[model samples]
Target: MAALRQMQTEFNNVANRLVAQWRLEDGDAWAVIVAAAVAMLLWLTPHA
Candidate 1:
């Protein structure tokens, strides 16, 4: 669909810009994100 194509194009543009600016390895970025998410989850969990 036209809408989906437009959304994809916009996403690609933003991602490209970020990739250019950040200059970080994609794998390293994802690892850091996952680690932060897990730490937040642990902090929020109620203990018995």
Candidate 2:
């Protein structure tokens, strides 16, 4: 539990830093995240 909490905290800190550095608006950050997730899913999907 403690390890998970620490990792979550670290992730939050890094995300905050990235958002500030990139000067991204809230919607832009979410859009970037969703786009990355979709790209990753497409990349991992097996070709038929």
Candidate 3:
């Protein structure tokens, strides 16, 4: 339980720092996120 708590605290700190560092507006962020997801899907799809 103690190790789990420490892991959660570390994860939260990293997430908070990432949120603070990112500059994209909500719309731009969503667009980029969706585009990346689509690209990832395409890359993973098997081509015949």
Candidate 4:
């Protein structure tokens, strides 16, 4: 449980950073959508 919690926290941090950086670089809503899509794909991909 603790490990899962840690992973979730780290994922959130990375997603937030990506969103912020992309938003700054693009200055548009598409940056946010792209960031979210990337994050979702990363999370959904199988890890084996």
Instruction: Go through the candidates in order and give each one's C-alpha lDDT.
Output: 0.60, 0.64, 0.58, 0.68
Candidate 1: RMSD over Cα atoms?
9.7
CA deviation > 4 Å runs, candidate 4: 24-48
TM-scores for all predictions: 0.49, 0.52, 0.49, 0.51
What is candidate 1's lDDT per residue for 1-48, written digit by digit as tens?
A: 676567557756665665566666877655655675576557546531
Better of 2 and 4 by TM-score: 2
> What 10-residue stretch in candidate 3 is worst by lDDT?
39-48
Q: Which candidate is the best by TM-score?
A: 2
Report the candidate with higher TM-score, 1 versus 2.
2
Best by lDDT: 4
For all candidates, the clash counts are 0, 0, 0, 0
* Residue pairs clashing, model 1: none
lDDT of 1 at 42: 74
Which RMSD values do the candidates have, in order?
A: 9.7, 6.8, 9.0, 4.4
Scanning candidate 2 in windows of ten residues, the lowest lDDT window is: 39-48
lDDT of 4 by residue, 1-48 (tens): 677667767877876777677775655645665777687668756651
By TM-score, highest first, what's the ranking?
2, 4, 1, 3
Winner of 1 and 2 under lDDT = 2
Tens-digit lDDT track of model 3 for 12-40: 66545554556556566556556755775
